[model samples]
Target: MNMRRNDVNDLQVKVIPSTINPSSAELKCQSSCRLPDRSSFIWYKNGQKIQDETSSTYEGNFSPADSSSCALKGFEHHPAPSVCVHGQSCNRVIYTDRSICASRGSSVDISCTYSSDESITSSFWFSPDRSHQWQNPSQPEDLSKDSQYAGRVQLLETEKGRSTLRISDLRESDSAQYHFTFKTQSFEWRSSLPGTTLTVTALQVQVIPITVHQSHMEAELKCLSSCSPAGRISYVWFKNGQKMMKEETSLYSGQFNPGDNISCALKGHEDYRSPSVYAPKLPSVSVSPSAEIIEGSSVNLTCSSDANPAANYTWYKENEDSPKASGQIFTITDVRPEHSGNYYCEAQNKIGSHNSTLHLIVVTDPGTAITIAAGVTAAVLLLIIILSVFLWMRKKRASNQSSEAEERPDNRERTQPEQDNLHYASVQFSNNQADPLYSNIRSDQLHRHMEEQEVIEYAAVNFNRAGTAPRTRGQETGEDPSALYSTVNKTL
Candidate 1:
C-alpha cells in the first residue's frame, strides 16, 4: 500500500540570519513543518525547480530575481506559492481586501498578509495624516495606543504573513485609507500603493414627487447610502409597518394617501433603516351644520387630512380659480344668499395633495322677513276695518227704523178717538183781515204750529196708505178737525 503525504496544509519559508545588508545578504530557506531526521527536500524558485539536493535546507546569496518555496522530496506537486523580497531589508506588507464599506455604528474587519526575511517584533495598522505619513507616536505605540482609536480598535489575529484589524462602533470620521505596518529586528515596513479604504455611511430615503391630482398623488422613493456597499445588495420596502411586495429595485412608485408611512432598508441591514416618510392623503370637509345651510348666518367649514408632514389648507368656490380662504377652518361672517354654492378645500403637503367638496345654502335675514310679515298683517287689518264700517252702517240703519216704528202709533191707536189728526186745511184769508185764532197767536208760535200740523198730515197720509181706517169730514169734525183744517188753510 502507498501512503499519501498531508499536502493540503500550508507551508512557509523564512530566511535565517536575516537580510540586513544587500551586499553581504546570504539567504537560507527553512520550512515550518518538521520532516524526518535527515530527510531530503526539493526547492523551487518562482515555479521552477532549482535544486533537488539531499539536504533539509538550502543556502545561497540573496538575489533580486530570486523567489523561493519548498516541498517534501516526492510531494513536489504541492509546493508553496512564491514569496520574494523587494527591498534591501527584505521587509514587505500587503492587504488582501483593498476597499470596504460599513454602516455607521457597525463593526468591521480589515485583513492583510505580510512577509519579511527577519523575525517580526511588532505589528499595527494606522491611517495617514495630511502629510501622507504616520503621525507622531510613543516608542511602542500601536493602533490601540492612539487616542482616536483607543478602545474601538483592536488587533484580532496575527500569524506568519497574516494579520486582521477589527474596529467597532464605526463613525463617519473612521472612513479613510488604512495601511498595515510591522517591525522586524532591524527593519520597519508599511504596505505601499493601494491600501484598505473604509466608508462609513448611514442609510437615507429620498422621496421624489411625480404627479398630483385631486384624488391621489404619485411619488418615487429611493434607498440611498453614502457610498456603494460591497457585494450583492437587496432593498426592502415597508408601508405603514407592513412589508411591501416590491423588492430588488431601489426605485419605488405608487399612489399615496395622507398619513401613510413609507420606509426602506437593505435586506441584511435593517438596523440602519431609513427614516419613515409620511405621504399626503385626500382631504375631508365638514360644515358646522351639515344640513339646512342658511344665508345671513355665521358658518364654519373645516378641512382635514392625514400626511407625513403637516398639510396646508385652501378653500375655493366651484367656479373660482383662486382660493377664497386659507387655513383648516374657513369662516363666513354674516353669510349672504350669494354665498350659497358648491365649495371645496385643498390640503397639500410636500409629498402630495388632495381636495374635498362641500355645499352651502344661505337664507333671508330676520329683519327683512319681519317687514314682509308686517305688511301682510296691515293689509289684513285694513280689510277688517273696512268690513266693520260697512257692517256698522247697515246696523245703524236698521236701528233707526226700529226706533221709528216704536215712536209711531199702531193702526188701532190711530183709529181710536183719543188721538187727534192735524191737517192743513185751505181757509179764505184776506190780506186786509186776519183770523181771530192767528190774531191772538205770536208769529213764532204760528210758525211752530204749522210745522207740527204738517208732520201730523204726513203721518195721517202714511196711515191711510197702510190700510188704516180713513176719517170722513163728519167723523173728524167731532174731534174738532174743522178747526185744524181752517187754521192750516189760513196759513196756506
Candidate 2:
C-alpha cells in the first residue's frame, strides 16, 4: 500500500534570545495551516526525532551547530524547514517590548533589555534608511546625533543589559520604528528584524448632551475623549471650576441652571479640560426712546443675554421666517408704520439659544397735524388780504366821482354870473313829463318863447312919471303883460 504525505508544509520552530542573558533563549513554534482536532506536534533536532519530545518547541541550552524543526505527531515523515542559529556568541542585541504609544506634547520612555558577552564600547538607538548607505562604514549610527532629535532625545538609563530612551515634547513626526545597536570590543550588532514602534497622539474632549425639556433645565451629559485611552480611564466633570462628578464611566446626568458653565476632562489630563459652555439665558430687549415711538423717526433696539460665550443676536418680526436683521444693536432709520409689529430678538451660543419679544407701537407724528393747521392759517390770511384790497378800491372810486362832479366847467360858469349882480329866477324841473306845467307848453310856442326871452334879457325899461305901470296892447292879443315885459334892476 502507498503512504499519503502529510500536508504540514508551514510548521516551523525558531529560538528567540533574551536581552537579559545572551546565552539563554526561548523556543516558539507556529503553523499556517489549521491542525486536526486532538492533534499534537513533535520536535526534531538534526534530522532525528528526540524520544518522548512530543511538543512542538524545546527550550534548553543549545550549541550553534544544532538545528531544530517541527512536524505533526502522527505525520512525522513530513517536517518543516530546519532553523539553525547563527552569529558569534557575544555580538547580539535584544529588546523587551517592541511597541509603545504616547500623547503628543508629553514625555515617553522607551526601554529594552540587552546582553553582551564582550566588553561594550557604546550603545544607542536609531532609525535606519535602508535606501541610503551609512556615511561612516565602521561606526553604528545614533538618532541623538541627528539634527531632528538633538535636544529632545536623552538616554535615561543605560547598563550592561538594559537601557531606556526618553523623549520629551513628543511630536507626531517622532512616530517611527526605532532600533537598538551596540558596539563591543571587537564586533558591532544591531537588532533590525523587530524594533520598537512609537505612536504620538493628541488628547481631545468631546461633549454630548441630551435635553428633556424646552428650557434645558433637566439634561444628561457625556464627556468622551477623542481617542480611547489605554488601560483604565476615569473621568472628572466640572461646573464653573467646581468638581461636580467623578466616575469611572464618561457619563453624567443632572439638571442644569441658566448660565451654568460645564466642562469635563480625563482624570489624568485635567490641564486639557474641555471648553466650558454655559446655558443660555433669556434675552432682554430695550428701545432707545422708551416712550411712545413715532413714525418717520429714528429708533434703536438692543438685545442682550448672559452666556459663557458671548451670544450671537438675530432680529425677527412677526410672521417672518427669516431674520430681518442681525447684530446686538438693530437700528431703523425713518421708521414707518409698517415697522410697527411684534419684534423679537434671539440670542444664541454653542450651548443653547433663547429669544425675547417686544411689541413696537409706531404712532403718527403730531407735527404732521401742525403742518396742516399752519397751511390752513396761511390760506385764511391770504384771503383776508385780497378782500380788504377789493373794499378799498370801491371806496376810492366813489370819492373820485364826487370830486369830478364838483369840478365841472358848467358849475364855474354859473358862479361867474352871480358875481355880475344878475337877477334870475330859479327853476326846478321834475324828471316826470306828465306834470301840468310842462304839459301845457306846446313845442313851437316853447321854442319861440325861449328865443324871445334870450333877446329881452338885457333890455332897459323906462318907467312913466310916478311909479304908474305901462299898459301894452299885448294884453288884448291874449298875451300876458308880465310875459312880454322885461325887468332889469340896477343898483343905484
lDDT of 1 by residue, 1-492 (tens): 232444312445665544566533333444454545665667765335667864656666656534556665665544444456334334455456656888665678898777667688877877754223335432323566677787898786756678888998777788887777777776665332335778888766687878876656688888777767666667888888888975667778888765578878777555556677775477888998654545657889999987655788999999989999999999988888899899999887767677889888665766565666678889999999999999999999999999888867775576554236454332333234332223233356655765754444321111122345455443445756556555455454
Q: Which lDDT tens digits does candidate 2 get at residues 1-492? A: 222343464566777876776655666666666566555677655434553434555666555544556666665534565565434443344445446776555567787765555677888887754214457744446777877777999986656578888887677678777777777776565432446677776543333446545665655666653444467667778887988654546777677766578877666656656667685589989999875577888998899998756789999999999998999999999988899999999998656788999888777976755666678889999999999999999999999998889788787798666455532322222323222121222256544654554532232332223334433334336765345333212210
Native-to-model Cα distance after best TM-score fit, residue 99 in candidate 2, in Å? 3.2
lDDT of each candidate versus the true structure: 0.66, 0.64
lDDT of 1 at 281: 72
Return the lDDT, model 2, position 261: 82
RMSD of each: 30.4, 28.0
**Local distance difference test, candidate 1:** 0.66
